[model samples]
Target: MENNNNLNNSEKKGIGRRDLIKGLAAVPVLGALAFSTSKKNAYDQNLKNSILRELNIDASTPPPTGPMAGDPVRLGIIGYGIRGKQLVKAAGFMARSEKEKLQKSALENPNDTRLKDFMEQENLNVRFTGVCDLFDVRAEEALDTVTTDDNKPKRFGTYQEMLASPDIDGVIIATPDHWHAPISIDAARAGKHVYVEKCMTHKVNETYELYDAVKTSGIVFQVGHQHRQTQSFVTARDVLRKNVLGHVSLVQACTNRNSDNGAWQYNIHEKASPETIDWQQFLGNAPQIPFNKEHFFRWRKWWEYGSGLAGDLLTHDYDRINCLFRMGIPKSATASGGIYTHKDGRDVPDVYHVVMEYPDFQMGTSQEKGKEKGFTFMYSATLGNQFGGRNTLLMGHDATLELLGNTITVHADPRSTRYKEMIKDKMIDPEVPLYSYNPMANGVDGVTSATAKYFANKGLLFTYRNGKRVDSTHLHIREWLSGIRNGTKVSCGIEEGFEEAISAHMTTLAFKLGRKIEWDADAKKIINVTEEEINQCDFITI
Candidate 1:
């Protein structure tokens, strides 16, 4: 999902050779496209059809006229963990509000007996039929939270038992990363829609497996990369796409943390005893080790269960960047870092920097005429606190964009004379917000008298561009529901999840191989490997 603004700029320039050249020059050397017998045009057409079919309604239908109609989509949550609780809460709120509005409207119009009867017969609120977890306490807690008389959700011990129930319409998976693929595949096979968390799966091959299952099962599947749904990111993509900063050349995105907790050093609660924790269930496919409370709760520290900082933090950045650029997976990846700070027995790296290559799809040797260049993307993340904050930098051909948490700044590339002049003259309208001093303030104040007074008294100031602030949390959930309701194409769907996982795997490969790694995207494997060779050599496994 490239920014609409950026698309407009590409259109304005006609995606010229100059743009292609700029992109190719910056990308890493190991990254190169290998065109073969496969018809690229045909493949793209198939992808378009797949996207259209996934979203049940066609482009002509225009998103369910008036208000969202039909019986409230019955939903079944299969996990009672933090994320599971969040889904129930958010979905429940939306469902309740929508139902209230319909009922109120029906009551106000007394003549409309059909409308009144419809409200009574078709309950608009979601019917949470089932909740499941291995532990009875967790299952009961989840059931207690969803105690709505309009729709009382049943509780169960195992996911299989819950899936057997005819009442379930969909499943919200919030289990550990390792369980993500298995549970999602099972749910899809059982003919249920799935809203799986980010990094979609634990291993590289599992992504393909899950993708096939979802496609074959004809089910709605959404990966939980919530920021994709956020208004802020949407607005930023739009602003950048419009060439507000003039031809972006380079992008730098990072997530920083100083505290141990911020880096997944979760505190163990006193209640986290063997009685409350299901040791065998938590272990799942992971090696059968003795029950350790820390491993059960803060499993992110262990490579056996989690993809470390790369999957947790970097994946979010990758998903957001991909949406902004309208690009897919990189050709090659390289990374360097270590557990330099906390020596808490974590297997994965505590800090890391990775460079991903997006080869120039159009570039050709001087031998070929009418050829264009491609683009490159570079990203990094670390635990060490630096520059005193977090940010995402988008570098382009004419200008460079720096996007801090709630602010964005654009600077001209020193090499471009025209870009420099544009910057000097401020040819770009000042209507686009610029971050100056007093960075703590929220950037979206609508210029009211109270806001003016607050800024004047505190010497605090910021500007709001014609940008939409994204609520990543809300968007993530809404996108999941939309995928369920309309069978819409998910922004961070299976392909994206696979692409990100592969990128992370390649980073580990490059670090271990101690050389730049190349990939054969067509074969879906590293180019030099033999049939029997273990792909594990490319990953950092515990």
Candidate 2:
């Protein structure tokens, strides 16, 4: 580690070699070292830290990934809205307007390292050959963003038209939830690799169709659960493997966003009209509604274009846990909640609660055999402060894990068998974290807006690798491109995506139908729920 640090010019701040090695003297593992509160009480912090130290991951070890030196992978982008723009930027391309905004911000405050971080982002050999967006303003802006001196990106009238073109090798599907499966299926059939956004499918049938299409296509497919690249999460997997948390019987993940932006009340652009936006193409298989700006701008608020909190936000929480431990589709799901907060004319629920049961699953127990078997995964969310809560908690018999964004903290249970001696001797406090992994311990990186803060906290924005700040989405895209270029395996492939989509869709159905939803893994169908019953759903039709 010292040898590597000596090779760099330690001139800059924040990400400098000397600055990065600030907190990693005693621990070395992906820059994430164990840390506790600075306020030292009566007992010494070192003694408390020594007894409960965990996360034995080798920080010096880098991921075995291939070099990106091949010919650029020709890519097409569909849907260039908020998420779409962010996705492209993560792939080493930022819009001129956003770049200028960052430049102004950096000029005002030296601490705003976003522009510097972006300029230093490693280039993944990929090119945008085509773009398909319903909005003309966004499409033209996307063309400007992707065009280069050697390669000029073309704007396609529709995704099918883009897929039919031989100029493209793969597609990035950032469209609404309803179009995720359709566009992905089209790309798969067109023999193009895909990097689609999360909540992979809007409906149950679409989920199956997508799974089948990707399987038959023989093309590289990757889902956009970018946090799969998070360093703390990678370490958390190791922690779970060592049974540091014992048998996690219950996991609770919450979302308590109060702001209008956090609640999906996005601003409607003034120039957004039928002339500027292709309203019909945007609708796709969704309900034929009279052109409404609210439905178009803030599509997440409606069930037609989005799947409410279950699909939009909960998928992140679900996939986060799923990635940590490959706990596939749950045996049963029970949901209950309603539109308690944002009472605008949207049909989808604002406050949501879902309980998914895994009857025959286990997370490797430290107790007697067969003692700890099944577990319940609970998801709760609200648009306001009434039912507000923070932190995604993994409650185990021996300890509890708090996954708040990029930081991971594990607390020993008071009656834990694994840490009973440490608790008895007062070497470890039940209230205090047994250990924690904070990658930002050396310095701080800040984000504005409640929504962006929420994502950054959840490790969706950026993470550090070998002391350098890196975007998780960029790593995700690079993994897809690597799979396309070098035949390497992708983390969030078809099977993982299937589980995420099915789990989310089941929870959504349970909430809508007011009953327990069960999945038959053997038959690969929703048990007790018929095709006709699923089709009759108003939200599904919408």
lDDT of 2 by residue, 171-219 (tens): 9999889899999998999999999998898888888889999999999
TM-score of each: 0.70, 0.89
Task: Name the best candidate (by lDDT).
Answer: 2
Residue 323 of model 2, lDDT score: 89
lDDT of each: 0.60, 0.85
User: Residue 318 of candidate 2: its Cα lDDT?
Assistant: 93
**Which regions of candidate 1 fall more than 4 Å away from where they truly are?**
1-67, 93-124, 239-249, 361-375, 386-390, 405-408, 417-471, 512-515, 528-542
lDDT of 2 at 308: 90
Candidate 1 C-alpha error for residue 116, in Å: 30
**Candidate 2: which stretches are off by over 4 Å?**
1-64, 386-389, 538-542
When summed lDDT is taken over every stretch of 10 residues in candidate 2, the lowest stretch is 30-39
Itemize residue pairs with steric clashes in candidate 2.
29-59, 30-59, 405-457, 405-458
Q: Write the per-residue lDDT of candidate 1 for residues 1-542, one digit (tens) a residue.
A: 24433644645644556556667885644343324324676675665454334212211111211223456666777766656665665554323443465567557755423223223221234667788775566677777766676878887667777767788877888877778888888888999888887668876667778888988997777777665543334455655545444444456766566666666776675677778767888887787899798887778887678778777777777777776676666777777788888787888777878787766533222223433245555666666664434457775554455654434455545544333453465543233423221222444233223323222221122221223232234445555566666666567777777777677666656665566666777777765433233245423244
Candidate 1's displacement at residue 149, Å, is: 1.1
